[model samples]
Target chain A: MNKRDIALIIIILIIAVLSYCIMNISSDKDGDMVLVTVDGKSYGTYKLHEDREFEIQNEYGYNIISIHDGEVCIKDADCPDKYCVKQGKISKNNESIICLPHKLVIETVRTMDDGGAGDIDSVAK
Target chain B: MSKHVAKLGIFIALAMIFSYIEVLIPFSFGIPGVKLGIANIVVVTGLYILKPQEVFVISVLRILLMGFLFGNMLTLVYSLAGGILSFVVMLVFKKITLFSIIGVSAAGGVFHNFGQILMAAFILHNEKIMYYFPVLLVAGVITGILIGFLSDNIIKALKHYN
Candidate 1:
């Protein structure tokens, strides 16, 4: 490869590293709440410390969300690939379990009153 | 003209096989949207051996066929987005002539992940999807470099055999 090509690759990698660090830094907040959404609309907010199982039915299918012992995860999902279920448990701020086909999102947030901190900011499923 | 079509068909078939092999292998790096992109080898090789039109046809056909065989509607959309973006980026890099085969393929890999994430963001209407960008970026570079190195060698072998 020429100098320019090498430079381009290096620049991309540097940006990647920087962005990763920034994302991690922002996600480090001590989260105490879980927010759920379907099709870009808010479903409800649940306390992370509570233990419960709830199903969200939408146009695509259903996702069974489980909140247990201060963490939340997809207990099961009817969507193909079971990617959301495979996401395991999430308790940290900005951590999310997404089911793209069902347009479902579950994220952990520090506060439920911020009105913006956990408003389905990202889809990482 | 028939001969050209036949050649494209063969290339597309080969690409499909690569795609199938990837499916059979349980190769997940624990990150969404990251892949080895083995099928990309065919597209990268075609960039040098086939005309631009032929390259596009082969790549798109391969993606469509693969989706039909092993993927759902969502998978098809993501693949189409990634494939088209990667192809376009590779073409631009090839035209630049400053990059070697490997460099071009690297660009293709990076852009492929970018296109998929962009599509995800649009569909979900969540900018948070971009949070996965950096991780996908690194995965793209690693896979792109691997695919580029393999394509470079494969092309050399084809030239020798020819």
Candidate 2:
């Protein structure tokens, strides 16, 4: 409605679009489980079968990570805010999920082959 | 003396009603503990209508009452952190930002989440949990927009309603 409004709108719109590109993203085939290795440890694994759900806990609380229909996500969490759980689902297009509180991320990448969307690696099952 | 008591009663009632609304809105994002926190609108209203100390008193009372009614003692920590942080953030925004009430309210939403998360990490002693910062920040961005957008429209309408 005014100049300030327009500026804020522009900033928000940019952020929204930039962020949209990161949602519903999936990873390449890493067998039945896509292991996101952060630092020296395996942060967690995404079980690629009919969109499974799991939880991983760090210092903060339990993070409910859900993978469904070939996508992965943080489904529920014990963290105070639960923002990661609220992020909805993510797929290959988005390719990764990150929760700041958990210092965790679930990303998609083929350890063997690159099949286009919907190609489920037999080993990844 | 009786009139003062009546005002307090009305304020408490309004807060309870708003808290109920906060729990009922259906915006589940498939993540645990995610909510729009709409009930905060009442606290924001208190901030504007009552003195800061009065607002503090009301906030403590509301959180305690709501916790007793619907939440556990553990959960009260997060609520208290969120409420107090929101007040601080809103107070700062009010001083410097030209944003409308909606914007101020949205900032409060983000602050509330931030405070809650900070407390969680502190209590748990897990600095790694801070990684959720970006994700929550993103959520805060979205929820802030949502609260701000709604409050903006409401603020515009409040003039005529009052």
Candidate 3:
């Protein structure tokens, strides 16, 4: 490896570090709700504080999501990869579990009000 | 001309074998989309021995054949995006002539992940998938370095044949 090679490696490392720091900074806010989207359309939004199991069945497949004690996880899924279930739990804002095969995304969000009117209102509109 | 074609065929076979080896290893870090990218060794070495277009052809053929045999259509799409982007970036880096083969291969690795993530985010219509970028970036650089090192040695050993 020459000087340029070392420089290129350092640049890539710096970019990775910067992105990691940015993700952490943006996700510092704790989320109180989980938003599920199928094929970019909102399926439902559930309160993180509630312990419940929600099953989503669509043309692509099915996934069972469980929220317990402010944490959200995919309890089960029929997607071939099972990557969403393997992703474990997430509670931080912007953190998410993605099921690519089904085009499903479950992400945490911070609602603007105590009643989560902001998310509902946006969804309604 | 026949000699060149024969050499390209050999590289393609070598790349396919590497892909097969990668599949058999079960080398998953559990992050999804992360792999050793061992087949890239052939791509990096090809950059030195073959024309840019020839290397591109080999890369595409390998992805298509391997994708059909071991992966699905979605994987084929991902591999095409990654492989094409990687080849372009590697070509540019190699053209500059300032960096060694290692740097060129490293750039290829990094861009390959970038392309795949971009495609995933677009297809999923969820920008949140960008969260995987940092981890993928680090993984790309590490694998790129290893592949680059191997390619450097291979190029040196094959200097007489070239």
Q: Give the top-scoring candidate (TM-score).
A: 3
Model 1 Cα lDDT, one tens digit per residue, B43-80:
99999998988899889999988898888888899889
Our model 3 lands, by Cα RMSD against the true structure, at: 2.5
Which residues of candidate 1, in runs, are more than 4 Å off?
A112-125
CAPRI rating of model 2: incorrect
lDDT of 3 by residue, B1-162 (tens): 897788889999999999999988957866777888999999999999888899999999999999999888888888999999999999999998988988898889999999998998888888889999999998898888889999999999998765
TM-score of each: 0.91, 0.57, 0.92
Poorest 10 consecutive residues by lDDT, candidate 2 chain A: A23-32
What are the DockQ scores of the candidates, in order?
A: 0.62, 0.10, 0.79
Model 2 lDDT per residue over A88-122, tens place: 65554224454544555555544434554445443
List fnat, each candidate. Answer: 0.62, 0.08, 0.83
For all the candidates, what are their Cα RMSDs to the real structure?
Answer: 3.0, 8.0, 2.5
Instruction: Give the lDDT of residue A82 in candidate 1.
Output: 87
Q: In model 2, where do residues sit more than 4 Å from their true spots? A: A1-125, B1-5, B24-26, B149-162
Candidate 1: tens digits of C-alpha lDDT, residues A56-120? 88779988999999999999989877888887999988788888888887888766445364443
Clashes within 3 Å, all models in order: 2, 33, 0
Fnat measured on candidate 3:
0.83
